[model samples]
Target: MSAIARSTEPRLDSVTCASPAGLHRMAYWEWGDPDNDRVLLCVHGLTRTGRDFDLLAQALQGDYRVVCPDVVGRGRSDWLIDPAGYVVPQYVADMVALIARLAPARLDWVGTSMGGLIGLGLAGAALVSPALRPSRGRWGLDATPDVPLGRMVFNDIGPALDLDGLSRIGSYVGQDIRFASFQQAVDYVHAVSQGFGPHDDAGWAALTEHVFHEQDGQWVKHYDLRIAQPFALQTPDATTAAEALLWRAWDHLPMPALVLRGAQSDILSAETAQQMVSRNANARCVEFLGVGHAPTLRSEDQIEAVRRFLLTA
Candidate 1:
């Protein structure tokens, strides 16, 4: 099959990862040549599955081996026994294991929302000495060479987040709601995902497909409800400290970085995007008008923006 055709036919696979509680399996979808060492890892937003990057992956599969992972507690991945394990540090550890399994000579990342934070955690570690890197004692991975993170794309995310946007996200997460039918599920997803910008009926349906699954004759969200526990327990002080660390991480990145933000994004403000470019010489910013919070790569212009950068970078 052609590369574009093969992109639609992703090879489903899983990687074994560990956490403070125990070992769990994380699911991932692979596209393009399996033997290719130039790897592109595309991660989705919180509560969204790896399938969110289906379009973007399909477009770039020919140029790179695209791997999209469903972070722990979401999609086909195993849920953590301890909800606190749902944090970014744990997710970073899990990605470390996945990276070891792939052992890419060069790696590129495209992360949306929560995925961006995970990328920061891993990318930031590259600046640390190999001996000080995450070891088996931390999450069952040996201290290997620093990650080969190359060009990166942060999809509508940054170190400093707007409180109002954070509040909007927290308000809907972890709700125990079920839909009567597939149509009902689609309607609900569109209602809450307006920040993803405009899309046609099919577009919305594709976005909804992996987010909700049928269980006990009802369509419920695919993610574990407990994933929201950390957000609930996080204190304002903790959030502030975390932001400081994230900014440090942002400053440490030495690779070419692209920040794709919605012009009216509540999550990544205009000021923050500007600051990101100003703080890092290797970073640049691009905004999509009429969009808010995020510009889903499903759209042609958005996908092209990422494609052009990765190709030239």
Candidate 2:
């Protein structure tokens, strides 16, 4: 189950997972001493790939082995034929498969948005999902057992949905439009993510590389547009159903959790973030004043917060 990946970063190895159906490859970045038993798994938000944690990974150094995966349909991973297949169930399954491949024995998780939801669903469901019941590669659902998830971090997302933001995002879903230039695409990304704080040219450039596409004479996005189908499908009656589906997953999460909210984020509203803090007793909460949707874990302040939590909590 070792995932195969190649990177310029030092002191880590890459591996790929053989997964279900059309899902073939899972690309991830690893850092720190491979023999170190402590592992940290960082999953990025939707529309983002695993490499987003490059800075956060570097800061942590040898404290723990950090493994970041590009969920199916994003980054170097394969796309699903059925857009609806991008649901949480499939994602949770992908993570389980990833854990099997890594075989860290015990691991902590840090997930943004969709990645957070997947972790929450796995930790809170108490094995509610049939796909997560296996222990040591064998079925053991209904038989309570120790889980691999240790410290969990959820960034700029909660059980509550920012309907307006959700709808606004849905408006552009499934459109396979390509930009004439990478600059244009990056500009669009910056405009859309303005709530996440002010980024200098270099910061924006790094973020741009994670998602933009430049092919021959054209520039486009790297991930499939179909990844938006679920959000698009949530309309009229489906919206309520969609909200309920998400709420259940968040409410049921049962592990040590930490939630990071961007101060200006419309997505993970302040009130909702408070509710998340209240909901999970053992869960610690923090807010980044100048950011929204998510706090870029690279900043010095963010690095300290994450490192403090990783080492002490």
**How high a TM-score does candidate 1 get?**
0.94
Question: Candidates' lDDT values, in order?
Answer: 0.87, 0.72
lDDT of 1 by residue, 42-81 (tens): 9889889999998898999988889999999999999998
Which lDDT value does model 2 have at 149? 52
Worst 10 residues of 1 by lDDT: 132-141
> How well does each candidate superpose onto the true structure, as a TM-score?
0.94, 0.86
Global CA lDDT computed for model 1? 0.87
Global Cα lDDT for candidate 2: 0.72
- Stretches of candidate 2 off by over 4 Å are 1-22, 129-144, 236-252
- Candidate 1's C-alpha runs over 4 A off are 1-5, 131-147
Count: clashes, candidate 1: 1
